[model samples]
Structure formats: structure tokens, C-alpha cells
Target: MHQYVFSGLRVSSEFKFTIADCEPFDGSPDVTIRFVQYLEKPLHPIFADEIVTAAPNDVWFCASGDLAYRVKDGSEILIQRGENVPDADVNLYLVGTGFGVLCLQRDLIPFHCSAVEYNGHAVAFSGESGVGKSTLAAALSQLGYGHVCDDVCIANSAQTPMRVQPMPKGLKLWDDAAAQLNIAQGARVSADLDFHKSYVNVDRADQTGGLMFNRIYILDNDIAPEFSIHELKGAEKHAELRRAIYREEWLHFLQEPRKTFDLVSTLASKVAVFAFKRPDDLSRIKESAKFLALHFDDGDAE
Candidate 1:
């Protein structure tokens, strides 16, 4: 079994993972992942769609082709691997949507963001898909910033200072971005033969202990030629943060509004939220990263 620490939980898996930075652990795992030859979907699902079928405390995620998964009770996962699917592709969904629901079941908030270490703490960037969260983080890394986590920032808001569990899986980027930035590609991440998506290794922060998460920047597109930053306040900030929840459609199946709201409210109150707007041009990513790096150094947001 592969043993490692992920999102503050001990994980033992039957499959090898390509994504690195998960520190190995020897203790009994909090979550166990088993590979099965065949697994069935939930009998009576509260939610069903082309991608997923969900029941209370149980969810079946369907990836492309024959790849499917069953996440249960926040403690175990049974994977039905596709015969021809690459392990890297299977791990993509396993660490993305599958672990997202697992975090919710474990009462942890999985904020959909790409984070970098700033001033000894975590500053996360969040936004809709294709908003360049990963690319911007990669850009900032080129400016000497350290990558903290990607895709999901596992947050424990119940704590006094809102700690984040580090789960850095390198930087996943599109082929165009990788080639444009001259980033070294690691592995092919597509299952359905879309070869554009792949992983790129970069400098990372130390994940020895917990890190306090204090800032979040919601990325927005701007028609202007320069970058801009605006602070969000009151209900707008709260609403924007709510929309950052990963796999939010599965919230209905989790069904813990009071708990969820409490967590969200605590996060909004603890972390500073801002609207960061930049041009959509990829060639200007370094300029945008320099703008953000100066902002971090100046401590302008704080």
C-alpha cells in the first residue's frame, strides 16, 4: 500500500500516484483507498447526472470512458479503474472531485483555489474555471514565490486562525501555457486523450506543519491593459467566497447548511477577500505576476 499524508489525513492507497509533495506517513491511515475490479453505483441516489450520482454520505463519480469511483463516509474510496486509462488520469479525478467531497464529509472546507506562500503564510487565488488561477500561481512562482497547493486549498475554519492543510500536487497547466512559459512537463493528465493538460513541477513551500491562511484573491478578467485590485466587503465578499467552494453541486447531498455556513462565515471573516483584475493575454503573465509580487511585498492588502 502507498502511505502518505494528504489534507491533514493519513491516506493509504492501493494505487501509485504521480503527483508529488505528499509526505509519507507510517501510522494507521485515516482514509483507505482500495482498487476494485468492479464496483456498483449508489442504489438510491439523491442526486444523479452524467458526471456523478450521489446519496447521503455516498457519491459515485464517473470519469471519461470506464473510470468510476465510490467515495463513502469520508473515510474510504473504492476505485473501478478503466482498463486502458492511465494512472495519472485516474489520479486527476481522485485528487480533484473525489477528495473534494471527502473533505466535505470530514467537515473540512475545500476552497477551490491555487495558493502560494506569501510572507510566511498562504495567499490563495480563486475564480471560475479558465480564469488562470493555476497559471497565475505558476507565474508568481517564477518570481520566487513558493507554490503551496493547487486546485483545492483544504481549509479548517473551526480553528482560531483558520489553518490550511497543504496538499501540493505540483502545477497542472495546459500545453500552451507550459510551452509559452517554458515549463518542463511532468506527466500527461488527460484520460480521454486530450493531451493538452499535464503536470509541471515547480518550487514549493515547506509542508512540515500547518500554515495559516489569511488572504484570498478572486481573479477577474479586465479589458484594460493593466492590472488592478479591489477589496470586496460585506455580503459581496461572502457571496464570492461561497462560490469558491469546490464541487459545490454536491453540497445538497452533504446537507449541513448550519455547519457549512458557519465555516464559510468564519472564513470570510478571517481572510481578506479582494477582486484582482488583469488582462487576458498570456504573454503578459510575467508583468501581472510582478504586479502581484510587489503587492505581496508591500503588504498593501493587509
Candidate 2:
């Protein structure tokens, strides 16, 4: 059996993983991932089909021709690998998206963000799909920022600084972004045969539990000629947090609205949130990274 501690949970799995940082859990794992030949259909009606069907207690997800996964009671995963996908492909979705669902069902705050640990705290970039959250995280890592996590960010919001977990899969980059950035990233790990998503390795930097979250930037896709930052407050900040939840469609069924509100408000009260309006030009992506590096530089944070 293969085992690792991920996102603050002790996870034991039946398959090897290509994650950046994986260590054996001294204690018994909180989540157990078993590999099986097949899974029976849910007894109850599925919440939805095609993508994910989430019941009050269980969540089931499938990839077109690779694997099918069922997440149960926020504590266990049943993965059925199809003949079509390689082992790495099966593990790709299992750890990335599948585990994110586990966090949501467990009532932990999971955000669609890529975070980097810098100086003494975590800095995260959240944005719409195709807006380069992973790209920015990659840039930061190349610049010597310790990687915290990617794609799906898990947080222990109950803490004062909202401790961020290291998902530790490194940066998943598309072909275009990889070409544009010019960083000598490791070999690409295929996410799906049908889709071109790829992952590049970032060497491990973890704190066992997590790192303190200091600031989050929502990379607004709103069209603009120039880049700008808008600091958000009160309701706006909470709204952004709500919107940032990875695969938020599961939230309606898995959690109460009031609990989510309190979680968002508490985090907002502690960490800073900003809406960063990025311009339409793709060439300027590096410029945006430079802006962040300079802005968060030692003297500038204060």
C-alpha cells in the first residue's frame, strides 16, 4: 500500500503517486483510498450526471474514458481504474479534483487557487479558468517562493491566519503557458488523454501541518487596458471567498449556507483579499507576476 499525508489529512492509498511531497503518516490515516475493479451505482438517485453526482453523504465523479471515483462520508475514496488510462492518469484526477471534493464534504474551505509560501506566509492567486492561477504560482516558484499548493487550495479557516495545506502536486500547466514562461520545468504528466492538461514538478517545501495564509488575489478577467488592484471589504470579500470555492456546485448539497457564510466572514476578518484586474494581453502575464513580486517584497507589504 502507498501512503502520504496530504492537505492535513493522513491518506493511505493503494497506488503510487507522483506528487511533489509525500511522506508516510506515523498515525493511521484519516482517509483511505482503495483501488477496486468496479463500483456499483449509488442506491439513491444521483444529484447530477455527466460530471459529478453528489448526495448528502456521498459524491461520485467520472472521467470520460479513464476512471470512476466515489467519495464516501468525507473520509474514504473508491477509485475504479479503467483499462484506457495509465496509472499516472488515474492518480492525476484522484489527487487533484477527487481530493478537493473530499475537503468540501468535510466542511473544510477548498478554494480554486494556487498558493505559494513566501517570506513567512502564504500568498494565493485565485481566478477564473484559463486565467493563469497556476502560471502565476509557477512564476513565483521559479523566483524562489516555496510552493504551498495548486489548482485546489485547502484551508483550515478556523485558525487565525487560515493555515493553508500543501496539496503538493506541483503546478499543472497547459502547453501555451509552459512555452510562454521559459522555465525549465520537469517532464509533463498527462492529466487526460482527451484533454491536454499537463503537470510540471516543483520540488517539495512543506510544514507538516500548513503555512499561514496572509493574502489572496482574485485575478479578475474583466477586460481592461491596464492592470489594477481593488481591495475588497465586508460583503464583497466574503462573496469572493464564496466564489473561490473549488467546484462550488457541490456546496449547496454538502453544507448549509449559514455555515459557509460564517466560514468566509471569519477568514475575511483575518486575511486580506484583493481583486486584481488583469489586462487582455497575454504577453503581459509576466508583467503581472513582476507586479506581485514587487508589491509583496519585504518593505512593500506594510
**Alpha-carbon runs more than 4 Å astray in model 2:** 20-22, 191-194, 202-208, 298-302
lDDT values for all models: 0.83, 0.76
Residue lDDT tens for model 2, 1-302:
77787777888888777764467768778999998887755667447777777777687888655588988888999988876678767767887778888887787878789887776677888988888898888777777777777787788777765677867666778777777777555545674456556767664455666777768899988888877786889788888878888876667766777887787778778778888887877667788787788768732442
**CA lDDT, candidate 1, residue 256:** 67
Q: Per-residue lDDT for 178 in model 1?
A: 85
Task: Estimate the TM-score for candidate 2.
Answer: 0.90
Off by over 4 Å in 1: 21-24, 300-302
Task: Give all TM-scores, in the order shown.
Answer: 0.93, 0.90
How many clashes show up in model 1? 0
Backbone clashes in model 2:
0
Instruction: Give per-residue CA lDDT, model 1, range 64-179, as digits (tens).
Output: 75789999999999999878888877888888888898988888889899998876788899998888999999989888888998899898878878778866566889988888
